[model samples]
Target: MSQALARLPGLGPRSARRAVLYLMKKRENALRPLLSALQTVAEKLSTCSICGNVDTSDPCSICTDPRRDEKSLCVVEEVSDLWALDRSRLFPGRYHVLGGRLSALDGVRPEDLTIDQLVRRVSAGGIDEVVLAMNATLEGQTTAHYVAERLEGFPIRLSQLAHGLPVGGELDYLDEGTLAQALRARRPIA
Candidate 1:
């Protein structure tokens, strides 16, 4: 169990062992529900066809919802970023998940992302704005710039999330509220 849990993102061997021990102590309550929830998520979760967001439904609840602003789109590097933005409750627009950034070292390219689909959505869906909510890392900025270049002369306003500090990335680690503030203070990328 320790080895299995150690494979997770943040859990080291020691943390995994501690977590496993805790789970063992709460086997009937926490452990069972956790196992069941993991199984359910693994079985049910799928990529949304429109935006690449993970959902039980193909189009995703956000894409289908009439309350969401169809004219504005937020482009993000991953579904995790989308969730972070959604948690802020500041955006009313829809989203496009790129899955990952362009990394020549890793052989990740523009074609590998959902850029073509995003362009199609912008052109065909009457989109007015595209907020680039990608990470603030070097690769993230490169990817965002590439997207902006591709969407040039498309009659859409392109913007990017602010830079300075990040809440999630370990700049010695940060708090969620600080991240939210950074997002809110985001400026357009020239």
Candidate 2:
């Protein structure tokens, strides 16, 4: 069990062992409920076909919400970034999760992401702005540029998360206040 838990993203062997022991000691109040929740999620969770968000419902609530700003779209490198932006409550726009960034060394390309689908979404009309909310990494910047080129001349404004964020900052790691300020001060790209 400890080894299994350690396979999860940030967990180490020692931490996982401690966590497993803790859960076992609190089985009734924690482990059972956690198991039930995990089972439920595994049974019901699905990726939103439109935005790549994980949700019980297709298209996800954000894509279906009538209150969202249909004329603006936030493009993210992954669903975690979408959740980070949502946590900030700074953007009312819909989202388009790109799955991952372009990485030449890793052989990831524009085709590996949802760039074509994003262009198609924008081309469908009503998108006045497209916010590039990728991480502040070289791959992220490269992917953003490729996307911007794909979206050029589409009439929609293109922008990115503003300065103040460190060079390698990621939206998922930023506080709500910082995220809000970045969104408020976003700059145009093309």
Candidate 3:
């Protein structure tokens, strides 16, 4: 059990063992409730067809929200980044979750992500800007550049999250305040 739990991200053997003990002590209250919640999530959670957000809704609440800015779209490398931006409540625009960045070292390519779908969305019109909010890594930047090149012929403006984010910084790990600041200070990528 410890080994299985340790296989999860951010959980090591020692931590898994501790968690198991704690769960055992509170099996009825904590452990059972957690199990039920996880089961429910597993059964009902789905990826949003429009924005790639994982939720109970097919389009997700953000995608279908009447108040969201349809003219602006924020591009991110993962669903976690989308959630991070949502937590900040600083962006009123829609989102396009790329799923992952271009990583030649890892054999990740543009086609492996939803880049083409993004192109179609931009080409279809009504979008005014697309914000590249990927991580500050070489691979992330490479992905952003590829996307920019793909979208160059379109009339939509392109921008990136501010340099306020440290090099190699990931959106999911940052606080809401920092994310809000970054979004507020975003500049055109050119």
Candidate 4:
């Protein structure tokens, strides 16, 4: 159990051991409820057939929500990224999870991702804009470019998430790559 818990992201061996100890000490309060919840989630949760998101419903609530803009689609590399963007609530649009980014070193490819599904979605029409919300990494950019090329010739607009310094980042502490990107993406404050 400790090894299994430690295998999870951000949870090291020490933390996993501590968690196991706590759970054992509070078995009635913590372990039982946690087990029950895990069982329920395992039994009820499923992947969304439309956008590849995990939810209790087949299409996911976001995919089925009528209030969301069907004309705009935000493509993310992972379901976690999708959750992060949705948590912000800044984008009132639909989403497409690409499963993973293109990485030749890691053996990930366009075929491994949901690029085909994305193209099919765009081909179906009603989409006006497609936001490539990939991470600021080499693989992410490569994947974004590949998706853009695949989406070429479509009437839809293509855009990418801006890469730059964080809101409270110090200029002196920043890296040159980030500074360069910030300079390149600079906009006039009208």
Candidate 4: residue 13 Cα off by (Å): 3.1
**Backbone Cα, N, C clashes tallied per candidate:** 1, 0, 0, 0
lDDT of 4 at 125: 94
Between 3 and 4, whose lDDT is larger? 4
Order of quality (TM-score) = 4, 3, 2, 1
TM-score to native of every candidate shown: 0.80, 0.83, 0.84, 0.95
Cα lDDT for residue 104, candidate 4 = 87
- Candidate 1, superposed: residue stretches over 4 Å from native: 164-190
Which regions of candidate 4 fall more than 4 Å away from where they truly are?
none
Please rank every candidate by lDDT, starting with the best: 4, 2, 3, 1
Tens digit per residue, CA lDDT, model 1, 40-92:
99999999999999998888999999999999999999999999999987899
Question: For model 4, how does the per-residue alpha-carbon lDDT over 47-108 read when each residue is reduced to its tens digit?
Answer: 99999999999999999999999899999999999999999897899999999999989999
True-structure RMSD for candidate 1: 5.9
Of candidate 4, the 10-residue stretch with the lowest lDDT total is 162-171
Candidate number of the best lDDT: 4
In candidate 3, residue 23 scores what lDDT?
A: 91
Q: Write one digit per residue (lDDT tens) for candidate 2, span 25-65.
A: 99999999999999999999999998899999997999899
- Runs with alpha carbons beyond 4 Å of true place in candidate 3: 164-190
Clash pairs, candidate 2, are: none
Candidate 2: deviation at residue 125, Å?
A: 2.0
User: Clashing residue pairs in candidate 4, if any?
Assistant: none
Clashes by residue pair, model 1: 162-186
